[model samples]
Target: MNTDESNNKGNIICGRCAYDANPRGATHCQKCGTPLVIASVPNSDPSPASDSTLLVGGISVVATVLFFAIGGYFFWQQVRVASTPSNLNNSADNISSDIRLYNSMKEVPKVPEGTFNYGGAVVFAPLRNSLHKAINQVYPKFGLRFTEPKYNNPGQNTGITMLLDGELSFAQSSKPLEDTHYSKAKERGFSLQQVAIGIDGFLLFTHPDVSIPGLAVEQVKDIFKGKITNWNQVGGPDLAITAFAFNPKFGSSLNILLGPELDQLSPKVQFMRDYTDGVRKVSSIRGALGIGSTGAILGQKSIRPLAIAHGNSKSYVPPFTDDGKQVNATALRDGTYPLTRRLFIVIRRDGTIDEAAGVAYTNLLLSQEGQQYIEKAGFVPIRN
Candidate 1:
């Protein structure tokens, strides 16, 4: 070997098996066959082979650092988005505030100045009276008036018929329009639209002489079905239980309370066409029991509302609660009390709505002031 080459070969050392150093130009240890490298020379430039290997390793390191940096940035962005607050609750609050403001200012008038005709369910008699009083008190100058509801015996069917026949401008119902009513109205080229105005809970009443404190839903069904013939069977006096009800075909509070069971009512249940007669029958007969709207039963001292349990539970809940002598408004509204029913104002779908008088009266019932009258008359106001 040349002298220069010999000097280069003398510089290499093996890191592994250090007992023997390799020749400076050798790539591996002579004794252990481990890879060897020359110690760095202070003033000399490295050979091209060493420079190429170091450049490839440096590039690999830079690429790995860039990949990690990009991954971390995307992960942080996703977390930031997930942590942001939502405005959904805020939007709901703003909407409620706007409604309150509109109601307070009377900024929007639902009806224009004009007279209108209306009729419907007899159950809405108290509500009609309240609406009449509200109009006289609040909008007396609007020249709007509602005729006392008529054709109210079997009120729902009667009112729907009247409205379709053009005898009434608008109708009120304690129940939604029945399928038969809809079909009849469609035949007459009109559709019925019902707007909810308030809520009423149907209450069961018994003569003061009857001593049962409360009853479960099933027990009530059994009593009306004549399975429990005597009051004693359901925890009352030994007298027979005389069940009074409206006509099976009539749409009344009793029909609502009984639901499909109305069709299955005991043949013994005496049917009346008028609720007033039913109430009187219940009061005069010592063993008589009846059901009617809470509003309708409020003032009669001869009968009392009986508490009802949910399903077969032992809990007894009254349809109405009074603090000493005043009605508990909150109790009626929260729906904790069962047997609640919705009352609706029915209008023609074919442009017959009284934009000024009809719409206004409807809106009045929905307003805060109007709801007060509804409550005063022994019905629960519809919640917004």
Candidate 2:
């Protein structure tokens, strides 16, 4: 029988005695007084030496050591980066002095007339777009007009900075304020704050080719890191499973939901280029698994939403209120669903008009009217 076919077969090769035997489950080798340990996958039958394996293994070892050296060089670069105050933060001198010099002339501030320049993540488009549309309809009586927002994808830090440095009057974001961003504004002598416009539920998604109704939390994690690369690994159809995620260049809500399941298997993961690519790969390949924020995936009929099975934690559940009025949501109050996260708007300490626009936009979004629009746009409201 093949060595792998035997459940407990092990081989220990001893340089001292040429002792090669199935030494599995033994405290010591039966034939020699050597400790027995499970070894890497080995050749079962006697075979000619593989020159390629010899060359490749030697190169691989040297490459690994060299790779770490390169990693150390990058680590040093990052440390230098982390230590230096970024232009957006700490370096007050970098921001235009006009920022500090602009006096708030109005005792009770009036909303600016003319088009207010705005930028935000793509995830906020539905809510923000609808709210902006409505704002123009009603707020025109108040002499307010908003330009259609220019935007970047969610969690893009640099884009936000670029938009703000220009004529942009306001900005929006789905992530929270960070120390660096705040430092930049404070250096500019600006006050900043963000609001929770609304809440969203991240859905555990699978290719429609996957027929399983749901996955346990751990199982979902196992699927994407390439560990459980077969449908049978997750109680589904017989198919090769490949976990798909967008490069973090795009914020991956999947990374947040998978959590320790990913962090624990740090060295095991291989990633693809982008989220759009992830979706495409999963849909084209049978039994592939992928995930995206509910905001991103909602209303895409081609994908399947998998209800998660999370044991009681924080009364959190999946598929919580599509409306925003419940004390306990079906998803959170119960342990039935799996993926969830809170997306927030961020601002710097400067509280520039950009922050003002975000705050204004959030106020409109959190209003009773806003929640209604959220559902219409296909997102679960945090409250309802």
Candidate 3:
């Protein structure tokens, strides 16, 4: 009914109470005391204050969308940072210091050449990067830019293997070239020169659960060859032995150890695939044993170093009694410890045996200052 007609009869509808109210904005209702106001339903949408609920709902949706977008961006950034280990500040600093040493070494009459790019894989060792960095900076001072190396898990001197394939100017390797590898270079109509850098050691590790008294050279080979497959055979625990060794391509220790000890590995050890897989499989095994560079086993508690020894003569000796702490470079070099290999920077002859960037870098590495980085990075220094 029309407001005017309804109001005159003293019957106004109360929207809130649904009671009949007196007409003309009465303070009290006629049928049931309730406030009277204008028409309950409006002709258009409600005013701003009255539509507050819908407005709040719209704002809430926008805020939720915005939050998700910001959250997603942060999550992606964290993943990126986690993956780039070489980009870390410490790694950069290590690179920079090596470069400085390279520059200083040139006072003895170094080459000044053009800017050129260089990089290649080195055998896995704590000092690998430092050695490379020292070389990289010096190469560039003579006008060569050393490209960052993308290290692959070791295989049989494939560091040089990559060089032959035209992937690198040189290959960094721990082991010397095999006859077959030399043949490949001969086939390519090029002579591969070996530049000796220094020596790097490999240490064997056992699970935190293992407690072997010590291991002799032959015992080590036996464990890896699958002949002695249980820790009890070596006095650790009564668990099966799962052995780990770096790939021959990236690391030469496997070949070094296998060659003299067993002549050639039983087909099982020779053909078994990749190095990373070996690390994974070995570390997870129940009573596992592993051999790797100091760099490779930094945080693993699952692997422990077993004592090694060689008698004053050629026969096997248990880890010796030194000044309480037993294993040292002497034992390793003497073959008392069993695992040892020489590391080097293998480069081609750009010039004479005396005049090349590679030769210049080799000399710098043996100097007192360059040897410091090598020592700090945790490797043996043949220089001093």
Candidate 4:
């Protein structure tokens, strides 16, 4: 066997013997009489196996390029659509529509055409002067007029009494109707209904000379309940605490401020005729303290509102802002303010023109336009 023979050129090699001297076209080895295998040439035409592999690889490469190209094209289309002026305008229009939806006031119900007498809590005087006047200007046919009790001062209790005595078509109240009101109304062969349309809060205020920053809710209750008699008891100067409040018979402001246990007010507690009277009295006395509506006492120069803390919490929230120029409406709406209540419209549900007028007025106050006026009049709108 020729073991050292080189088959560098295109020649055959024996499969069974170490022979490489077979001719290019031979099928058998000359030295061993065994089968011969042909060697492949470089740069010649490819075989079927090589062709099949190349075909599959080519298809894969083409498919990958096409996939990337299609994806890129769709992404470019999306970006183009998003940045177009028409789409931008559509987005702006959607935002405007959303705002309009929030402040829409298109469906205010109608009232009967006649002069109606309505009056109630002096706390609602601002709303009556502003929102009521605006309502008249907007709907001139609804002739809503504010009236007061001729014999006594106008207040929540007086207004409800007048309503029960057929002196008023409707009344505005700062507090909810109690069971006693329902009982009285039933005795009169008519029932009273109240619709809450605004949010209000009670604020404890004192003379400008008093330097106490705030008080705990329990401390306030105790002061009004005659348990705490000296200003020094609740972190103030050593002065006799003289508390002033509206008579509970005239209005429920005191009830809402001091809770239901108001039977034992301080011996020094003086009942004022109204909030204005309380303000005047408190401003004159050295150690005078008073509680009134946040809307009423917000901007008073003679007296200043005090911050209040709830339970054992030390964080005190003032009813006014830091500058003392505006009410802290966020706190009132979120219930962070310790003393908050609702303002209501009291209407007799006796199926008369008074009922129609009352329902219509309540609807107006709860409507979007009316709520705007309510907020303008320094009360939190019940709607928004």
129 in model 1: Cα distance from truth in Å? 2.4
lDDT, candidate 1, at 233: 84
Model 2 weakest 10-residue run by lDDT = 94-103
TM-score of each: 0.66, 0.56, 0.57, 0.69
Q: What are the runs in model 3 whose C-alpha is more than 4 Å off? A: 1-122, 131-156, 186-189, 260-283, 294-302, 311-327, 333-336, 350-355
Q: Record all residue pairs in model 1 with backbone atoms less than 3 Å apart, i.e. clashing.
A: 9-24, 9-25, 12-24, 111-356, 112-356
Task: Report the C-alpha lDDT of model 2 over 277-332, residue by residue, as the tens digit.
Answer: 55676677676666655665555556666666664223334442443222123453
Whole-model lDDT, model 2? 0.47
Candidate 1: C-alpha lDDT: 0.59
lDDT of candidate model 3 versus the reference: 0.49
Give the winner by TM-score: 2 or 4. 4
For model 3, residues 87-136, the per-residue Cα lDDT tens digits are 22222111110122222454424554544333443333445566557655
RMSD of each: 27.5, 23.0, 30.0, 31.1
Native-to-model Cα distance after best TM-score fit, residue 179 in candidate 2, in Å: 3.1
In model 4, which regions exceed 4 Å deviation? 1-107
Q: Which residue segments of model 2 deviate by more than 4 Å?
A: 1-110, 140-172, 258-281, 311-329, 332-336, 348-352, 382-384
